[model samples]
Target: MAKRPKVNPNEMSFLDHLEELRWHLIRATLAVVVAGIFAFIAKEFIFDIVLLGPKQPDFITYQILCDVAKSVGLDESFCYTEIPFSIQNRTMSGQFSIHMWTAITAGFIIAFPYILYEFWRFIAPALHENERKASRGFIIIASLLFFIGVLFGYYVISPLSINFLGSYQVSEEVVNEIDLSSYMGLIRASALASGIVFELPIIIFLLTKIGLVTPQILKQYRKFALVGILIVSAIITPPDIASQIVVAIPVLILYEISIFISRMVLKKERKEKIEVKSITKN
Candidate 1:
């Protein structure tokens, strides 16, 4: 691909920046729409084979969990014959709305790289050439982290939550029946939230670059961050020690990774500054 000529932000009018941003947004939207079209067309594959995969008893996660539980001489808590729930549509238009929105969500996920490219394009011109070079793999790294988080949420969090909540009985008086919209919402939220959470290191990198945060500050607040992460874990997963631990472990790892990223960014900034000083002295 031919390199894009960098625009000098100092010479560009405010209106010009807005105009450039508009087209980037337009292209991002187009990419999502095109991906959504495919999601809509392959509704069965997306819905039955992918989205509803966790809801089935035969899911890999359930099988693995069952094996571990049985080996430990505990109840095979996850060995469900079937998820004790039925997902239903309550409204006349609920199914259609669900279809459209689900497709859009899938579209956004599939076309995320393109969207990130547009986002980078919008901001790249404003950054120093060296900064842009340093961030050349931002989109790829971000996408990879996001997809990993999605898989984690799908394979770990979703099944954990679904199995616990699905089988939980309140005196066996209430049968579990979930609305289609509700189940879909849970799946989407878990996936997207985890995806965003996994971008902690990237966020830390940006914040460190802009002088808003540092490795020292992160270390200083380590205890508080631990508490906050626990609370977040409770919110995302079932209110249980095991579930919370499962969700929090990766997030804690990400936080530690963010500290490392911050240290690296700060070190690089200092080196660059020293180089500038040496150049001026010469």
Candidate 2:
């Protein structure tokens, strides 16, 4: 839905602005809660099909890896009948807590577009008509990138981490019995962290709009960005070079895309400024 023009914000007091922001936030929260309710109801689907899928050796990614291994005459490390680790709850309330938080996370992910819409509505009053129009479909693009990142994390990063760390053993005496909270934490962090990380282009767009970044600055810091991506990958994935590289590649691609977004923003801003100057001369 298109956001309607808000009343001129300059006429409103500080309290009024706060009140307006509060309502937008409330609506966004409500949307998340509503989506969360659905997630809670569909616990089987979320936990079984979506969340636990990565733990199974026969998962799509694992299957593909196994197939590639056979084709290359390499060891089929991914083709076990089951994963080596088992997830359990240490506390009586652990299961309930995991359920609630997982539902909430799912809700937030599902209702992300609505939340972004509320955010846009809240800020629309402060923007000129042209600026608002130029930012059309911001929510959609951001939502798409986030969903892609979530899928990537689930399909690639989560699986690889699970396969490697879940199967790794320090000695014959040690067993990999992962706690419910720990397992869920890894999945949650992987998915949510990747989603936020994929917002690089959007962040760059906003920075460019505010004149804080340019194509040249991005190019100049490209090497530094690569280092940052590697650091982030190491933090998110297990201590394996393959998983880190897998996670870092998309982030590097996103960084390049961010540069392009910054360039486009600059081009649009300059064209708008030129039009304004031409109008003033006329």
Candidate 3:
């Protein structure tokens, strides 16, 4: 392969920018693929422990839920010795397909920080020097929020959902023999959805910086946002009130943090503009 010439981002044409973006994407994809290979190799851990954990009664989440329920004098549905449902591979190649896709999802989650870094590098050139410096911790903060969200989903949301859905049956005659793909899909959706939702603060920061959002607007629409969050929580979690509340709390907290972040961003921008004006007058 020929050596790609070094070109300044400021002087780059549309095609040059496209080429740059392509390389960034390629590197990000390679990172995911590499991480996926490791996850694939660790199939025993991934499948038996991580993926199948919620089905087991002795899982940490279930134990905690049992304790909490007992203390709070609430329903002890979570204290069951076993989940009644069984996971099965109905179709030929079902297990292999689930394994492959699960590995890829694992890879994406593990490689998320590097993916963020690649994304930041692509956009960094367009930002002013001070802007880049101010947001230097972007990748770290975003990654931290994402990982925290994943843990919350895995530990809280996934367990609650799996317990309720896996145990619920229309009749005693109908056994809950969930397909392998379907079970994996629920786990993936819960974790990824929560992780993405936790990026609310970062999204708000960017929107505020670009003058598209204000703290006032977020405050004014707080009621609507709460409704939306509850709706989202309901969709992802079981039909029970406790489950929905558990899911909504963190998201609502994140929304409030987003509002604070937006306020700070605007304050910083105002201070910068005043300094610029003073400098111009001087």
Candidate 4:
């Protein structure tokens, strides 16, 4: 591979920047492909155990909900012996397609940190030394948040949606036999969406850096954010208040944390500016 052209921070050409970005993207893609291959080899564990686990009644999320219902003296409808729906593949090549896609998704999720590292490497050279140091935990924190969101989606959101949708019926004549592709699609969507959503803090950090967002703005728009969060909760969770609230709580918490992160970024920026001014005066 040709060496990426170096771009001076103050006088870098647009073409030079593009060349640097291309190499970073190439590395990131290679990492994902390698991770995907590993996932492909672990098809049995990924599909039978991890993907289908949410459909089982003994899943931990269902168990916890059952306990909650019992404690509240409510109906134990959640404590199901089995989901009413059966997953089937109608297309001749559906199974193979799903396997390939699922492995790719798994690879992306597993290799997320390395991907972020490549992205950071591409951008770090442009940042001041202090800025780079300040963001040293970027990869680790981002990866942790992503994995936590994945777990949340798999254990909470996926099961709730699957159970509700699978068992739901408007008419007794209807039988709920879900397509295999549809089932896997739901799992993939929920997991990936949650993973991205969990990057709120990092998003806020960048927005703060760019002066596009501030703690005040977040606070001022708190009500709107709450409404948006509820809407997102409704989309991700089952059409039940309990499930919506369960999903919304963590998101709201993340929003609050984002506000704090923005405040910290602003504080640091202000302190740095003051020091710079003081040095100039001296």
How would the candidate models be sorted by lDDT, starting from the highest?
3, 4, 1, 2
Q: Scored by CA lDDT, what does every candidate get?
A: 0.90, 0.89, 0.94, 0.91
- What is the overall TM-score of model 2 with all chains considered together? 0.95
Clashes of each: 0, 0, 0, 0
- Where is model 4 more than 4 Å wrong at Cα? 1-12
Candidate 1 global lDDT: 0.90
Candidate 4 lDDT, 52-159, residue by residue in tens: 998888888889988988998989775788888899999999999999999999999999999999988888888999999999999999999999998888888899
Which digits, one per residue and each the tens of the lDDT, describe model 3 over residues 1-282? 567988889899999999999999999999999999999999999989999998899999889878988998988765879888889998999999988999999999999999999999999999999999999999999999999999988998999999999989889999999999999999999899889999999999999999999999999999999999999999999999989999999999999999999999999989999999999999
What's the lDDT for residue 241 in model 2? 88
Q: What residue pairs clash in candidate 2, if any at all?
A: none
Provide the lDDT at 26 for model 4. Answer: 87
Comparing candidate 1 with candidate 4, which one achieves the higher lDDT? Answer: 4
Which parts of model 3 are misplaced by more than 4 Å?
1-3
What TM-score does structure 4 among the candidates reach?
Answer: 0.95
Clashing pairs in 1: none
